[model samples]
Target: MQNMSLRLRGLWADRSGLAAVEFAMIFPIMVAMYFGVVEYSSAISVDRKATQVARTLADLTSQSQTIADADLMSFGQAAKAIMTPYPGQPLVSYVTQVYIDSSTGAARVQWSKELVIDGAGNVTISGTAPHTQGTTVTLPSTLSVAKGTFVVWSEISYKYTPAVGYLVSKTGMTFRDVAYTRPRLVLCVTYPTAGFSNCATPL
Candidate 1:
């Protein structure tokens, strides 16, 4: 009985594998924390990139007095370039000119362009403006402008997927942002391809 008691005491006092056991218990928690932080940081970065894409599109278009189809295409390409190191396939952007009616204060679409990026990074710009000319568009209340003036509107959307599915969503999350700017050199930006010579031709 004494011998058995001594063996039991020795086993209780032994500390040889304690460190390994503690590590085994804590390693998973540490890894989870690390991945959670990584996923959150990546998502935030992507969201900022999305906002930048929107701002870039609007800023570039507003700086030009007149916009051509080729120019619009170049703007889309610039947006895609801004999203480098991140997948551009899940991005879609639009640039539109909104004109506020002098008499009624209503906002209408002057010219709109749609830019789509495919899964292979192939860019496609609509041959014709997507939104109908003269169609009414709702502007944010904060984006008020003088009557008969014009504002350039840019909208961007991106789907962000985390590197590891364990921490963030496994499928994908969508981030959207919009920016508005007035034309830099002209009262309204015109698109000749859409047939309106100037901003005063009834639309």
Candidate 2:
């Protein structure tokens, strides 16, 4: 019985396998934390890219006095290119010209364009504007503009999926951003192809 007790004490004091045992207990948690951080960082990067996409669309459109269908398509392509190093097929972007009423200070859509890239990398520009003409759109309070002026509005959305299902949502997540800018050279950017003679008139 004394020998057995001595062996038991010796085993309790043994430190040779302590590291391995501790490591075995903490390995899974360390791996989980590592994957979680990677997924979180990736999500943040994609979110920033989404914001850049929106800004690019709005900035490019705002700089133009007159925009045609081809110009809008080019802008879409440029916006898609900004997502390089990452799959751009899951991105959706929109460009809209909003006119604020001079008398009532109400904001309404003059013309809108949508760009969509499918999973197969096929690009599509909507034939019909998603936002109806003359429909009211709420602008952010911080985006103050002159009552009679126009603001170029851009929106971007991206669907991001984690490479590993261990940390983030396995199904996926969507990141969206919106940007607004006043027309650079004109009161409003006109969509001539859409049959708008002036910025005040909605097509």
Candidate 3:
């Protein structure tokens, strides 16, 4: 009976399977942390890309000699240029819904759209003003061309894929960094040389 008891004790003291137990205990935590880092990194990248896209759109619209209908097409093409690396399809789709705030009182072209999927995996868009429910966007208002320069509002969004899908899945875990820039020409104006009577119209 004593020999049997000694054998049971030796069996209980054996270290076999210890490493597997430790690995099992630590593996999930390590995986969670890894995914967290990836999510954070993706978020940072998206933020930087969002800024680039906004600046590109703003620069293109502002530097152009004119912001007319034909020129707007160029603006779309310009958007495609700025949003590199990421597929242009989503961004291009959002561009169609841009709106330039031409309200008589306000000198601004308000353009806005969503680029990423919500927590629910739904495509969404937002704007300074209401917009049509579609991919690309545009807004129209009375152009007070003479009084003040027009404000150009450009917005873009994109959803990130889960590089580490094993850990977490939620909406707020992802975000879109929307950006805004006023046209550089906002302070300038184009009008007739002689106020009114002599020229076509006052600036």
Candidate 4:
């Protein structure tokens, strides 16, 4: 019994391999943190790319006086290019030309188009009637989209799945961004394919 106690005391006093034991215990946590940092960085990069995608679409579309089906396809390609490095992550976007009515002093959706691209490289375009047409969704008062003028509204949404990050709330974290800009080269832009939308009869 006395030798057993002595052995126990010797074991307690021996500090050999202490650092290795502690490192072994904490190794998993350190790995987790490292992977979390990588995932977090990836998320931030994707979010920023999504934002740039929205802005790029809006900017490119707004520059055009009139947009045809082929032009819109080009814009879609541009958006897809912005997300090139991260393959398989799709980009869903909407481009709406909103009109500020002089008669009603309200902003309404003149024409809207939506596009969805999935991980498998499937592109879905909305063909149904644009519902937001004439919907009274007001714009920010601070900005001035004058009466009889048109502004391009772009919205982008991306679903990011973190590989290993504790900061993520769910498996699919959706990041959304919206931007609006008046036409740079034209008073109004129109989708020529949808209901034959034009500068005068944008529907």
Candidate 5:
């Protein structure tokens, strides 16, 4: 028993393999932490880029006084440009002009254009508003338009896929953002060819 005790004491005093053992225990945790940081940072970048995408689309549309099918197509193309370094196909976006009726103080969609991108970032556009056009829909008081006033609302959605996808709870996360602004260049933007009209209709 004394010999066993001496051997244990010698082993306890030996530090030759301490660092290797410590590193063996710590290596996996360090690796996980490193990967976690990289994935989280990448996700944040995509989310913020998504917000900018919505804002840029809205800003571009608001600057235009009129939009046609071709114009809508151009707007969709612009959305892909806004995505920049990010792949655009995973993005879905749309632009709508919300008009407020002076007589009844009701807001409705006047014209809307939506865009879907392909794997190569080319956009396919649909001129229909996702929500009903020329029909009353709820609007935030802040977005409330004055008599005959119009606001352009832009909506965007992005699917973020991580390089190490398993780091997140799901394989990916969906990020969405919406932005609204009054028309910058014209009282009411017109989409005469969008299959819907009556620019000044009140609610």
Candidate 6:
């Protein structure tokens, strides 16, 4: 009985198990923190990609003077090409709003669209409408368009999904990006014409 009692006391007094117990307690927290970091970086990457796609589309529009009505379809295709690797099904959609100055007869255009990111990585295009309000949404009539001319505003949208789903909230996990660009120059060219060739000619 005495030997058993001594053994029990020794076991109760030993400090060897403290380190293992502490590590077990903190391991989950460390893992969670690591995952949080991954999630943050993933979000940042997606944002940059979204921005790049928008900028690329805008630049493409600005560089051309022979943009025809049908070229809008090409723009949508290019937007989708740029926004790859996202987990959600990705899509490209655009809206075009035209504004004309009553006094100067100059024209201005603006665009705004939603880029929806789904749970899996796939892309599609939707949304082509006019804006009815706000200041920034409206551009100057004399910014570049010719007098009494119509301005075309296009809004492009793409859907993106995060890589680290476990880190971010499952609800509203997708992302959206929109971009707009007005015609820099007006060329008297119609669709399916050689205008694109001349417009695309390097300056």
Clash totals, every prediction: 0, 0, 20, 0, 0, 24
Model 1 Cα shift for residue 31 (angstroms): 1.9
Candidate 5 local lDDT, 42-159, one digit each (tens): 8888888889889988888788887777776686777777667778878888788777776777777777777888787777875456767777767777754677677888899888
* lDDT-best of 1 and 6: 1
Residues 48-154, model 2: lDDT tens digits: 98999999999999999898888888887887788877788788888888888888888888888889987766667988786777889888888778888888899
User: What are the runs in model 2 whose C-alpha is more than 4 Å off?
Assistant: 200-203
What TM-score, computed on C-alpha atoms, does each candidate reach?
0.93, 0.93, 0.54, 0.85, 0.89, 0.58
Off by over 4 Å in 6: 1-15, 68-70, 95-156, 174-182, 185-203
Q: Which of 5 and 6 is the better model by TM-score?
A: 5
Worst window of 10 by summed lDDT in candidate 6:
194-203
* lDDT score at residue 166, model 6, on the 0-100 scale: 66
> Where is model 3 more than 4 Å wrong at Cα?
67-78, 92-147, 167-178, 185-203
Judging by lDDT, tell me the better candidate of 5 and 6.
Answer: 5
Q: Residue by residue across 158-202, what tens digits does model 6's lDDT show?
A: 444445566787543445555545556653122233212332221
User: In candidate 1, what are the lDDT values of residues 1-203, reduced to their tens digit?
Assistant: 99999999999999999999999999999999999998998899999999999999999999997878788878888888989989888888988888888899988888888898888887888666767778998898887699978889999989999889778888979999999999898877888986655877648
* Residue 72 error, candidate 6, Å: 3.3
lDDT of candidate model 1 versus the reference: 0.87
Superposition TM-score, candidate 5 onto the true structure: 0.89
lDDT of 2 at 182: 87
Candidate 1 is scored at a TM of: 0.93
lDDT of 3 by residue, 92-170 (tens): 2233212232344323322322333334333333332233322233234433333333344555655555555554455
